[model samples]
Target chain A: MREVPVGEITKVVRDLFIDANINLGEDVLVAFHKALEAEESPTGREILDELLENAKIAKEEGMAICQDTGLAVVFIELGQDVHLVGGDLTEAINEGVRQGYQEGYLRKSACHPFTRKNTGDNTPAIVHLEIVPGDKIKVIAAPKGGGSENMSRVTMLTPAVGMEGAKDFVLQRVRESGANPCPPIIVGVGIGGTFEQAALIAKKALLRPIGSTNPDPELAAMEEDLLRRINNLGIGPMGYGGRITALAVHVNMIPCHIASLPVAVNIQCHAQRHKEKII
Target chain B: MAEAKRIKTPLTDDVVGELHIGDRLLITGVIYTGRDAAHKRLIELIDEGEELPFDIKGQIIYYVGPTPAKPGKPIGSAGPTTSGRMDTYSPKLIERGLKGMIGKGMRSQQVKDAMRKYKAIYLGATGGAAALLAKSIKKAEVIAYEDLGPEAIRRLEVEDFPVTVINDIYGGDLYEEGAAKYRRQ
Candidate 1:
């Protein structure tokens, strides 16, 4: 067994969280420039311009791109052959978050659901862990903000609805979300799983780099079609109306029992803040 | 694109009357910041007939929860949050003559009706453009609810803060107008 110290995980998580908040990835930046050129609405184009400038300033000053700073959603892919040593993995991750938020001047967004009491330290990150074949550990920090997250939706359509139903559902969600999810948004569609699994993969789909395509030919075509229809909705950047409401549509599909066709649309704002590292 | 029109705070009925949906504005002067937590408390105070932390008449309230400022700055990255969350609270404030709201996203019909009734306007700031938005805020001080952390009500002094009219007192809706002009599907 290859022994890996948990402390290293803590450090990586801390730095990744801060970096993701402060920086905009190149893929997202490229997508922004493309949208800027294609956007026909004057206001929509202006909003895009401001967003580009915002990213540049955030990078130069090493400050967060948005004040929401977001709830830390960490994904851990642990190789089956690796043994974690030295400390509890979960605590170490939370410790990293606490330190990062304080040191980076990041906002603490997590809170009690009912009373709305602040957690103060931004602890207990929403962690998704998967075990794979190698001995290496991979970590991704995607800080999710409340505005876009609150607009996301999920529904279990009966199997009779099929592909057309799935497509319609995504369109309806995007239409209803309108300007609320911060358009030119990224639409992540998770299809053909159980209720909870659908939501999981839908969010997981967002981690894919923007302006990238799905490897599956069938899914890629669907993504292309959906992207076209969504932009046609006329809910341009910041919902001020234009031809480029959604920058990309990522679909992740897996087989499910014969009776269910669950779908979850995880909407991501323009910031699209995420950073990943393989150790 | 038209040149942005400059406007000052303490927006009165006459000043608000000249504005229309789709007009770009450079707002200079004071705006008080509040979000979900702070709005809830302000409503509670209204219901209880208690004094508000600041005068609401003819003032704009920005829906935001800003980050902590860096060592030399007055505030950190601050931008508009979604307005729908405050829909319920807004009508009550507008009933008391609040002039404008700065946020990102659609307002409820009830809120729209109140704006029409009260001559208030809803302005759209580019959502997620926090760092760029922060450049206009020259000063910020927590005026109330300090324990709410980011949700605290802050009095911000901004210069050339950019926004576009999403709704106006004359019943114009920029969001609807803009979308309808572009929808082909």
Candidate 2:
């Protein structure tokens, strides 16, 4: 069995958090540039230009791309042949989140939901783990902000509503969201799963690079269609209005009960911060 | 279309009235910062007949909770948070003569109505452009609710802070009007 030290996971997670916050991925940056070209509104084009500049400034100065450093969401794919030694895996991840947010000068956004008490450090990060076939561990760090997370929605539609219903639901969500989730957003659609699974996959879809299509031909077509319909809503950049409300729409699907068609729309703002490390 | 306007803080009804939906603004001067927790307390103080920590008359409130500053920096990335969350408290604050709000997103109908009635305005700053926005903020100091951390009330001095007038005193709304103008179908 391949042995991996748990402390190393902590260090990696910490660095990933800091890195993801300060750097805008090239894919997201390219999407912004493309949107800038397609956007019809002069004000919307200006907003897109400013966003590109903002990304550059954040990277150059080692500052956060956005004030909301976000709730740390870590996805781990642990190889079955690997043995993790030294400490509990989950705590190591949280420790990394603690160090990253504290030392990186990132905001500690985790708080008591009801009482609104600050957790001091952004700890107890949301961790999702899966046992994979290989010997290497893959860690994905995604900092999810409250505004976009707040705009996400899930609804279980009747089987009769079918694929058209699913499309309409996502479109409605984006239209209703308007500028709230920060327009020029990315849409992640999870379809054909159980309720909870659908929501989880919808969020996971956000991690995919913009412009990447689904593996399945049919799903890929649906993604393209949804992307078109969403932009047609004219929510535009920061909702100033234009032809580029959504940068991309990604859909992931798994088998579900024949009687149900559960779907979730996880909205992500244009910042779309995520990074992955394999070890 | 009118040219983008340059304005200063302690915004007055006359200046706010001259603005319209879709007008770009370069706002300079002092603006107060608050978010969800701070807004709750501000309204609570108003309801309890306690004096607000900051003046409301002719002042602008920026709905933001900034990241912690690094050493040698006045503040960290500071961008506007979603404004809808403040809908319940904003009208109450507007009733007290709060002249303007800088945030991102669409406001509730009640807020639009209040803005019209009170002659206040709502400006939309670029969401997620925190780093760029921070450059405009020359100084930031926590004025109240220090325990709230990032949600603490801060008085910030800004120069050429960019924003678009989303809701103006004359019942104009950029979100609605702009969407209708550009929406296909």
Candidate 3:
């Protein structure tokens, strides 16, 4: 087995978290430009301009893109052939978050649910670890803000509803979300998984580049149809009203119990902050 | 949507009366900032019949919890958080003579009803455009709840801060109107 020092994991997490907050991903920027060209409403077009300018200033000044830098969400694919050494993996990850939030000057938004007390240093990152076949570890850090996250939802559907039911739920959520999630949002839907699995898969779908086609032809078509329908809702940028409400809709599907049809909708704002590294 | 009107802080009835939904405006002068945590504290003070940190009359409160300003900048990425979360507290504050609020998203009907009765208006700043919005804030100073970190209340001196009216005393709701205008299906 190849032994990998856990310190390296900490370092990777720290850098990825910081990088994700400061830099808006290239895919999101391209979507903004594309939306700007296609957007029809005057207010929608101007809001897109402001979003693009915000991205530029955040990059040039080395500042966190938004005040709500968000909770540090780490996804790790641990290889079966590798043995982690030197420290506890969970502790290493949390240390990285504490360091990143402090050094990056990003907001530490994690807090006690009832007391509403700040955790001080964004600690105890939501870490999702998966055992995989490779000898190398791959990690992704995505900072998810509260506004968009608050609007995401998960539900179990009867098999009778099928795709039509799924589509309706997705559309309703976006319509109700309106400006709350910060419009020009990305809608990630996970279908056919268990309760928690559906939510996880839906969130992972957001890690995919905006507007990229799904590998499965069936899923790809649904993604396109959903994207078109969501944008047609005309929530527009900042919900000021326009032709471009959503940047894209991405769907991920998996088989489940014959009786169950679980659906999850994960909404992502235009900031679209994420970074990945394999080591 | 004529040329953006110029608004100074500590708003009065004349200015509030003239502003309409969808009207763009550039606000200059001092405005105070607070979000959910600080707002809860302010409301508790009101419940106990204690004095607030700042006077409420004619003042505009911005719903934002900005990041710490790096050196050489007055504030870091200042942008509006979702306004719905403050619905519970806004009515009480609005009744106390608060004239305007800057935020993004739809407000509760209760908040709107209060706005209509209290002669206040809701404004929308481009959400997620924090880095750009920080440019308008010339200065920032935390005035209360320093322990709340980003959620602390701060006083900001700003110039030409851009926003659009979302709710007005005449009962205009921009979010509803804006969406209906664009909904094709």
Candidate 4:
């Protein structure tokens, strides 16, 4: 059994949060560069250029790529063979968020929902933990800003609505979203599972690298189709009417009840800030 | 369908009226920051027939909640937040002489109507470009609602703040026009 000290976990979480906030991951940067090349509309191309430039400035200046800095969401894959020493795991994660936001100068966006009061420090991270068989502890941090998150939707449709309905729903959401989510955006579609699970899966799908494809051939095809349709909307970059409204469309699916075809569309802006570390 | 035009800030009726959908703007001068909580409070003050926290006449409000500034910086990454949430309070603010807004997404018809009536304009900043956007803000000082933390109203001095005219005073909407132009036939 591998015993990881609680202090080490706290340090890892703090460093990961700070790194994720200030840095735009290389995969997302590469995707933006590719989008700039593929964008046919002059305005779309210009928007892509600005996005790339923004990433560069953020990296060079050690500033957050986006002001929202988003809610601190941590996904932990804990090994059953590992034991945590010292403090509670959840508290350690929250403390990391507090330290990172404070030290990194990242915005503290978490607030009391009804009162709309700031949480002062961005504490109480949204942590999702799962126990796996490995001896290593893996943590993934993704800061989801409000614009794209506001556009996220989950619906349980009758099985009769089928794949076409799902596609249409996603396309409609993206179309209506326009420049809000900061195109060229990423569309994460979660199909099947229960309603909540579908939403979770869609959010999780966004953590994957921008251009990676689903292993399943059918799902991959659907992703392609959705990507085409979304770009067809010509929302362009920043909705200035261009050909490249979306950089990618990713889908993650799981089995659901026969009567249900639950779907969730999770939108992510061009910033696409996420990072991972292992302890 | 008109060519894009670049404009500076501290906007006037003439500048706001000349703007059309899809026009690019590089704004300078003073702009303020406010969001949902601040908007609600500001409108409440207006409704009560009291003076606002700041002068709203002929001013632009950015829908943003910025990160804490690093030492020696005026502000941190301060990109615009989603605008639709501010739709409710915007028309009223426009009625009171608000000239422009910098944020993302579409607004309600009432807000559009108010824009036309009041000669106001709504500009869409590149959402999520906070760090990049922050470089343009030369100064930021909280003017009101300090209790709101990030949502506090801030008086900002800016230079070359980039934006696109999403809704012009003439009732042109870049969102609808842009989407229609790009929609598959």
Q: TM-scores across all candidates?
A: 0.99, 0.99, 0.98, 0.97
Off by over 4 Å in 1: none
Q: What's the candidate order when arranged by decreasing lDDT? A: 2, 1, 3, 4
Measured on C-alpha atoms, candidate 4 has an lDDT of 0.86
Query: Higher-TM-score candidate among 3 and 4?
Result: 3
Which pairs clash inside model 2? Answer: none
**Candidate 1, pairs of clashing residues:** none
lDDT per residue for candidate 4 within B1-185, as digits (tens), equals 23446666677887777777777778888899999999999989988999998888899999999888889999998888888899999999999899998998778899999999989998888877777789889999999988888889999999888888888877899878877877785
iRMSD of all candidate structures: 0.7, 1.1, 1.1, 1.9
Greater-DockQ candidate between 1 and 4? 1
Could you give the interface RMSD of candidate 2 in angstroms?
1.1
Q: Which tens-of-lDDT digit does each residue in B57-147 have in candidate 1?
A: 9999999888889899998889899999999899999999799999999999999999999999999998888999999999999999999
Q: How high is the CA lDDT of each candidate model? A: 0.93, 0.93, 0.92, 0.86
Model 1, backbone clash pairs (residues 3+ apart or across chains), number? 0
Task: Report the poorest 10 consecutive residues by lDDT, candidate 2 chain A.
Answer: A227-236
DockQ of each: 0.86, 0.82, 0.82, 0.70
Q: Categorize the docking of model 4.
A: medium
True contacts kept of 2: 0.84
C-alpha RMSD in Å of predicted model 3 compared with the true structure? 1.0
Better of 2 and 4 by lDDT: 2
Quote the B-chain TM-score, candidate 2. Answer: 0.97
**Sequence-dependent TM-score of model 2:** 0.99
Error of 2 at A155 (Å): 1.0
